[model samples]
Target: MRVHEMTITNDFQPQYLQLIAHRASTYRSDIRIRFEKDNILLDAKSILGMMILPFRPGTVITVQTKGTDEEEAIEEMCQLLENKTS
Candidate 1:
């Protein structure tokens, strides 16, 4: 398993959530995002879950991924969460 923590810097819209879900679904690893303050943990591949994901700037999120491609999944997820790429 891989764990990463970072603050979200982007204001994501519904379309971006959909894109995130799509990207998550392409990976074999089990990806989950956790909001510590809210005590919420959601699967990245679930559209419904992604829809409610916290995207407010400065919100800290912890990403957990497990499985064969966890390394790559964590890297990509971090990039997306940090808004390092489009």
Candidate 2:
């Protein structure tokens, strides 16, 4: 398993959430996003699960991935959360 904590730099709008869910679904890894302070953990590949996230700039989150592509999955998820991609 791999895990990384990062602060959200972009707004968690519906489009962004959709992008996240789409990206996550392409990977074979089991991906999860956790808001530690809020005690919320959700399947990153589920649009419905992602919709409940209280994400905003500066909202810290932990991303965890387990499976063959965990490293790549974590990297992509971090890039998305950190706004390193369009």
Per-residue lDDT over 25-56 for candidate 2, one digit per residue giving the tens place of the 0 to 100 score: 99999999999788788999999888776887
**Candidate 2 local lDDT, residue 10:** 67
Error of 2 at 53 (Å): 1.5
TM-score, per-candidate, Cα-based:
0.91, 0.90
Error of 1 at 42 (Å): 0.5
Q: What digit string (tens of lDDT, one per residue) describes model 1 on residues 1-86?
A: 99998888778888888888898889999999999779799999999889876777788889999999999998988887777433
Question: Can you give the lDDT of residue 25 in candidate 2?
Answer: 99
Highest lDDT among the candidates is held by which one?
A: 2
- Report how far residue 70 has shifted in candidate 2, in Å: 0.5
Best TM-score among the predictions, by candidate number: 1
lDDT of 2 at 40: 88
The CA-based lDDT of model 2 is what? 0.88
